[model samples]
Target: MSDDLTKAGCCAGTAREATDHPYEDRARGVPPADAVTQADLRTRLTEIPGGIFEMGTRKSTYPDDLDSPVRKVKLDPFLISPTTVTNAEYARFVEATGYRTVAEAEGWSVVFHLLLPDAAAHPHHPPGLPWWRRVEGAFWAAPEGPGSHWRDRADHPVTQVAWYDALAYCTWAGLRLPTEAEWERAARGGLARKKFPWGNRLEPEGRHAMNVWQGDFPRHNTADDGFVGTAPVDAYQSNGYGLYNTTGNVWEWVADRYGPRPAPGRLPERNPTGPCDGLQRIQRGGSFLCHVSYCDRYHVHSRTRNDPDSSTSNAGLRVAADL
Candidate 1:
């Protein structure tokens, strides 16, 4: 489950008992789960029905850890936030709780060197990925460097928040991080074996569905999707289940600790929760910097690992709840 932040870059919804959106798994005759509406779904939480679905991939997926072998994962009904927490939302939590993020405590964080202003220079680089740079005071509020602020990005997903920080936010909000299995199932959006959340095609019929690197890797970004870095949480189309930014946004922290897939040729796992213990926790979804030519780990099944206290320009969180 160990992965490199050298690659992890970082980056909501409402309504309906999930059963209403059976269109996602209609092909397999998957019926909706019981209907129990949660009267007060925080701001924007979608109820994802419990059901069995495939996890991991069988086809080609690059930069894929490959440690998570293909398996069937069954989940119970639960409510989950469709988008990652926005800066405005996090600010509210901070104002109410006087909470300080790990990045703020450390006084520095990693930012894409390309994104930082010229004055915010740091000689350090992660070898081949020179785009990543350490900057002083580059937490979520100051994403690029000390000069940056979330004022202009109030609606964008909050970045530079570590796993411990995310857990803290969840605790304050009475929410929890989705387990790796729950995350994959939600990201799948009820579709079967598709590459991206939408389908096998990256750009269906020549239309960009989500935000990721549009041009060359690191060197350039065409911004064909109208965004170069992080886009609004709901920037693209939702999958059949109506979850936004499940893929190709920011690498989101999940509930599982880093672990290897079961031994080769093992049976399918049921409600699998990752390994007993590890230094790094799991992160799902790729970031704006993910390019097929380089990382290519932005697909639905893609995942990586990072230190629980690590924060960067590309990491964020999505909250979930039990139903």
Candidate 2:
């Protein structure tokens, strides 16, 4: 992979795995057959009225990302959580079901090199992406590996979760991961053909709207956005729909698989779920690790994909339900 692709992938891009990894077989997961939903789950969700909105971009920055040829997408009304699942929220799920995350089961997950207290101790790096380090014991609870704890970051979006893990959480809650079309609709916040949830300008009125890389990516972050890592899930201004941190705090797993996108004229008119079968699942928005210089995927229309079994420090989940 090229350096740009590798670096972008390190943020919201696909995960590169080695064939010899010990946990390869154990990474896959399925929702529990007896999953139950909490009665109060919908009370905290924001209702999105069904409608048609333009999807994709006419001005494409990354061609390979396939975010072009703007098309109209119609969605059914649905309810979505205002924020990505928080560390505290996920802890409740784990405690209730005694569910073990893939990272915890496999003994390791990918972590940002800068988050490591001693980067040298974890010498393994994914090929072409030295910024990503394979760290032992780096699950959602121990976000940065063994010594780090999620107690202090209870409000922050939970990370190091695989797509299947998100699915498990959704099933248990009687909710589901939002379809890629639904995600874009919620992220757009009723806007039309804009680059971001708020508007085209990134930092509207000289104020940082979301959490994203402020300085140099990978090597240095100026922390101009008041965060170096994951921000509180409720951090930054809520979009028009009252959804918080939809783009830059972390990449959120969606229901669709990476696609054989239909031609613009052939696009599905109502709630398109993308392809029925694929190896990788779609993840929308971007992460704290994204920057214009390397990975500019924080926009509402932006997207990327990774293997369903892959786990990373900058990926997370949000829930949606039929209204």
Candidate 3:
């Protein structure tokens, strides 16, 4: 184990032995996380006066990407969280209801490669990238790997949560997950046809502005962005619209369902939800796992999807509401 893991209690069994459920045979799906109590939620609403913005990517950008089918969208004013949900905020939900996260309850959660130590020492682990481990006892509270708690990461985004879990939190908070369109609009930070929330340049200068993979990827992270794993919520500057960490840190769940076919070239100008139903839900804002060599979905218009019931160490949520 690495020194950080030791300090973070990665090898400790105190939290691990607390697991009452059996491992190996645990069902494959989101086991409930701490439930939301009536009081844990705080609501803030913003009315985005209706307007038209050029939706999707332009030809100059990564037009080949599915999410970049540039089109116009009209949206009604709505209120959304100024920042992604934090660990401190999520802790309130857990403390109030005694909710056990899927990873904690099941005894394992998938962790990224760079987050783990060398695989030869931890031989029972999966292969390929030793970083993506089914870490025993990993959860939102202990995001780095098993036994690592969220005490220092309280202000960081709450990860290792599923779409359903996000929905549950949204319900408790009297907010909802933003539709894919709404999410993209807010991520753009009111900048029309911009490649990123900040502007056309990925890094305005030689400086690293967002928390993304900086080195060889999977194997090495230079932490030039000042983050190895997740950064504090306010670690970086906010986008033009005052949204923090909107482009990186963790992938956020959106309310829209994934469509096998691209959305119609001509979409409703106003507040369009996604397809009626699909196998997966949309996820946006590429995670800390993103790198230029692999999984560069960090661009504002980029998107990916996964099973709604699935939860990974890199997944989290932000809340939105109707105006």
Candidate 4:
């Protein structure tokens, strides 16, 4: 947490080092995979009748993320959680398996500077991303360093969970992370080429559709969406397919790997899983921190990447299963 901390390697040493902050030499450990029988998941997972859909966007918001070269993607029917994994759901996994998240194993994680209870007390800033702070003792259980806990936000989507942590939870819950194409198909909510799940308009009829930053970035939040950090999993209206918080609340980790933009003339890919040798994984949907002024990746086609062991205050996961 000190300013003198230099950039170090991540939990997955074979992968590239994290550019954000220094880390301890913790070996990447996989959580124990439990039996694949989740009765509770049967009721929570919504069936998505999959088919071919135009993936990506022609009107690319962030061209470098490769949100362009729209392609036709086909997927078989699958079941997905209506919302991101909630704190209560994750608690069950922790209590049953006694598993520890990567953030907890590393003894620290990234937290938004403003979300810190005493931002002024934390003088050091993360590299490149000055809006974030490398907070000691920040993990899924205690989100805002040591003082804050997830007890009050049990219904909210669990954050500060690394991609590996999410995979562990999915393995324990008898589920899997959705493919990037599958995620986009479900997030579209049956709409075609729309910026949002609802439509092109961010706010339809002057009503907030999802939880996103409503004010100037890294400065002030109007909380016009009724939430500054995270909202309840089902806080907003469900999408056309009865899915909630598909576009906002948290950046959801998908099953695909991160790669460069596709060639413009390449043919359609059937159930693409990104490049076979790619390292970092892809995160879709945007988080509550997303704003037009700064990180406006809340739209359906938008995406970003992070190492498998990366965890933050605004990232979480949604589970998917075979139908």
Instruction: Please tell me which predicted candidate would have the highest lDDT against the true structure.
Output: 2
Worst 10 residues of 2 by lDDT: 1-10
1 or 3, greater by lDDT: 1
Residue by residue across 1-323, what tens digits does model 2's lDDT show?
11112333436422534233333233223333332346577678999989888999997787777778788888889999999999998988788777787677767787888888889898777667778887878899999988899998999999999887887787667788999999999999999978899999999999999999988778998899898899999998899999999889899999898867887776547789889876777889999988989888889999988876678889999999999
Candidate 1: segments with Cα more than 4 A from true spot: 1-43, 59-64, 263-268
Looking at model 4, residue 66 earns an lDDT score of: 82
What overall lDDT, based on C-alpha atoms, would model 4 receive against the true structure? 0.79
- lDDT by residue (tens digit), candidate 1, 1-323: 11223433222000011122222122123222223312332547888888778888775454346534567767888778989999998887677667677667666777775676673358655545566776767788888876789988999999988777788777667677999888888888989888888899988999988888878767678888888889999988998888999988788989898766675344456667888965667889888877878777888988877767678777799999887
Best by TM-score: 2
lDDT of 3 by residue, 167-190 (tens): 766654556789888888888888
Report the Cα lDDT for residue 299, model 2: 94
Question: Which has the better TM-score: candidate 2, or candidate 4?
Answer: 2
- As for candidate 1, its clashing pairs are 9-314, 10-314, 10-315, 11-314, 12-83
lDDT of each: 0.73, 0.82, 0.67, 0.79
Full ranking by lDDT:
2, 4, 1, 3
Stretches of candidate 3 exceeding 4 Å from the true structure: 1-47, 59-65, 117-130, 261-267
Q: What TM value does model 1 have?
A: 0.84
In model 4, the runs with Cα more than 4 Å from the true position are: 1-37, 264-267
